[model samples]
Target: MASNMGIQIGNAWFQRKINLRPQHRGVHLVTEEILRQVPELLQFSVGLCHIQILHTSASLALNESWDPDVRDDMEMMLNKIIPEDMPYRHSCEGPDDMPAHVKACFLGSSLSIPITDGKLALGTWQGVWLCEHRNNAGSRRRGFILIAKMASPRNQSRRPFTVCIEGNIGSGKTTFLNNFKQFNNTMVLQEPVELWRNVEGMNLLDLMYKDPGRYACLFQSYVQLTMLQLHTMKSPLPYKIMERSVYSARCFIENMKRTNVLKEVEATVLEKWYDWCINHALIETDLIVYLRTTPDIVYKRMRARARQEENLVSLEYLEQVHQIHEDWLYHRTLFDVPAPVIILDADQSMEEMFVQFEKCKTRIFERCRQSERESRLLTSPVSSPKIGAASE
Candidate 1:
């Protein structure tokens, strides 16, 4: 839909998850199957559509749609490349299982296609393919996240400049947010630790710490929901600061998966929800203030502060958390950094930390001011030039 001012409306972004019917061990054309489920695709004029298959045994691709022989040949080629009868250790499921994993990795799991005039801008011979590697796989789930520029003025004022304080467990994020609370036009939101400690008289945080294998999923689910709420909460102030974010929760999930605390299915489900919330909700962070501290330093701090729930927190756990944070925010290897990061040495004293905070404060204020200017520019009406008027 176009507005009276000749701007596109109501189709800026769209997301949907669909199930593809189970297929044999072959590459099959699924372009129509996907498009049928997402009729909203027609609403987009120009944008990019990203389709991601959620299974490790099945993958997605764009390839020849005209001939069945092409699809068969592709599947045959993949099997030859990663044959099933190899010396594989991960063969508990079946011979095809390990090879399926390898095949999915080779073919990849997602596709990004350009949208033009309410249609997928694929070449004449191109179509989407679902390369099902397993012979008896269940229905495959795929998520579609799309974005298109709207014709409306980009009024960024409604969206405040959000900063997420990220760090290890005892890296003084609460202290950092506390120091900034004195600033005018800034809204400081601390993490809902109290909520986690007493969720309807159940100490979820303590339970997870005590028996992670039993309650890790339950604890993390609540945490993800609460973090999502914080991220999407509205504030009248121009600058919004949060103690942590959904992105950090994703990092936690990754660590849990790596440490075998979360089963693959459970992790995949959480990740799918994360992807959906990030795309569908108003959760955007402009900056990330990472309080970088070594595992040993934070372990000492945790022991000193000595919360009962964290009594079970060992230095080994802190080390794993530290490495995950480093890989994410510092090394930039594990996951996507949601925003630009400003690493601060958090192993310093309160006085030194305040100095670092002051520097970050300057940057935040500048971003807030810039957002205000852009809002004003977008909202201000354009003045018509006077016709036949004398030149100044």
Candidate 2:
């Protein structure tokens, strides 16, 4: 038999394979004892765990609820997609056979799961299952591969070298923006919704947790007003930062489209508004940063802020908003925008996240300068000296 190839690099790699025979039914042991069997597989903090089934008709999984019914449901679904006895040119093996390989290949032969707390981060109902689709369930010598990396402490004080944050209400945008303002040689620009805080008949509070269908016009109108006031006609301050941009209004509308909240007529109006901003708005971004947080966190932080409008927000409603934000950003990535995008996971603390922002800024500025130098070389009549002395 051929040996399985593997390699470990640094203090953060782990792998082990377990052999299984055909007809070996029932849950196989996945305890620390199995890990102890491989002496070289230890010594990593936290990383990805990847497993591959060697046989074409075999597979692996973390069974949910340990229920046979779930397995039956999965098998039924796969068979529907690729029937066993349908076509048979490849029947060189057997009638119910080669297609079994086809089926397994289609279904997938590997899985990668995150490892945390020194164990796989599977839910209570989940378990690892090695599936065998071949009739010959003899000792088939199936294998398991475990990979890991060492976990290091989170960076708590990383500054925002370049940062731009945007999100819906109670989404922790301001909280993150303030932290960025405090670090680096920073100047902060805040969103201008404060002006609409006193608009009469505006039930901004109701819009916080309810469907945005009825309030889209009002919200966008208010957004336009705020942008008009916030965007200075003059050039932005050097090294200064903005919380939201003129383009963010388009992002909000894209989010509304994902939730079925914006009607056809509303979408038309929003497109016009977006075109106007693109053609006429003074706003420009060095890097666009998006904050993604769970709705549960949004509501929790909303209540923490003690705002009357945000007090009544519910977990379920905020979940919808979270989904909207996720979908919107995903669709936005399909387009080629003028600026680079940096997506920040909002679950981290202020200090930890700032470090990430700073790293992004450093990378972005380096790229920007490189692009400028290349452009000068391409367009200039003569070459200038390189910015630095020759390397040793």
Candidate 3:
């Protein structure tokens, strides 16, 4: 397993070692074979995917999952990494040697991907590309090593998948998710906005007055159910888009924990789910859209939305949510939340905001696909027990 300190193996769900002649392009051929054999590797829950090109003139890229347009775009993008017109000293072997290394470095020497449900943890539009950046025409052996292990069905299925969107309550999660549902192949896993549904036989006024503790538990259940709901859905039905994911669960849990309302069992389950989501969630498309807004703007937007939940949402509550969003962003940036983040000023015009969203479409869709693959791999039924969090 330890081939070398820096040199490690790729995850087995999808891996390959192939001999390639120079001037080879078009999906690297061997990647298809590797992907074809992925179902067998899905048995393993944890592993690293290592890929090394023996030749200096080739590199690997993962931008062409199932679309030719994306592939073309990526190819065009690579052309800029090392310009053909740029001066180079290492042209003795070929014009591409130095540039190839430059290009490879630009792409990456290796990538570590998670394995779940018998598939590679790549997005739908993401694919393994062996960028043959050289002009030499000799056979070069490329190596790909996959390291992975099998996990039990219980661990895999029970693992929760969360997608968190941090913004003030009026920060357009509902609108974004609704629009996201139209073109996104992913599922719409909605956050439980109705606190009333969380508690049995308790009115909002009661929650405001008597047992805020009960309200917290009910809300936590709703949060847990929201996370669990993503896994419960039979996929092949488009990956899911959870309006608020486990991170939000953490946000709420912290509130309850501070209030001493979290029970032992609840704490255990919440911890388990949180750990699983952080580790195995394959959260590439998991975005944190920060709708930066002032308190007045937040209140105005909340009022405009006119939802029942917003009725009791006082200025103090809105301020708290705003503070949480700020805290979430700070921690997210510090720890590197597992996805690309898009920040849109709340004041931006709808047309401008949409244009910005369009600019990020390629990255977003690819992340979605990657997240889906990860979810499948983690949730797929397995026959044996496994150790470590889903992330590990």
Which candidate gets the maximum lDDT versus the true structure?
1
lDDT of 2 by residue, 1-392 (tens): 11233444433354545443334423333333333333222222255667677777766656664566876677667667767768678887776577667766765777777665334667877666665666665566334455445443222232233335666567667766665444434445566443344233244535733646687766776676556434432211234456776666666666567667788888888778767766776555556667777777777777788866665556765776566556556455433455666777777776876787677667656755666577679878965668896845
lDDT of 1 by residue, 76-175 (tens): 8998899988999999988999999988898898888887655689999999998889988754433333233422222233677999999999999999
TM-score of each: 0.57, 0.46, 0.44
Candidate number with greatest TM-score: 1
Q: Give the C-alpha miss distance for residue 62 in model 2, angstroms.
A: 66
Error at 63, model 1, angstroms:
73
Query: Which segments of model 2 are wrong by more than 4 Å?
Result: 1-163, 180-186, 199-214, 228-233, 255-263, 328-336, 357-392
Worst 10 residues of 2 by lDDT: 153-162
Better of 1 and 2 by TM-score: 1
Residue 301, candidate 1: alpha-carbon lDDT: 92
Scored by lDDT, model 2 comes in at 0.57
Cα lDDT of model 3 by residue, 1-392, tens digit: 01222212332233333333234542353455444322234334344455555545566666656656665666667776557767787677666567777877777755555565434577766667666666653445334444443332212332222244556667766666665656524445455443233232234433632555556565565556545444343333334455665566566566556546777677777777777766765443446565566667778888987865457667776676566666666545323455556666765556766765565555566666777788789989986646663743
Off by over 4 Å in 3: 1-164, 194-211, 237-239, 256-287, 330-336, 366-392
What is the alpha-carbon lDDT for the whole of candidate 3? 0.54
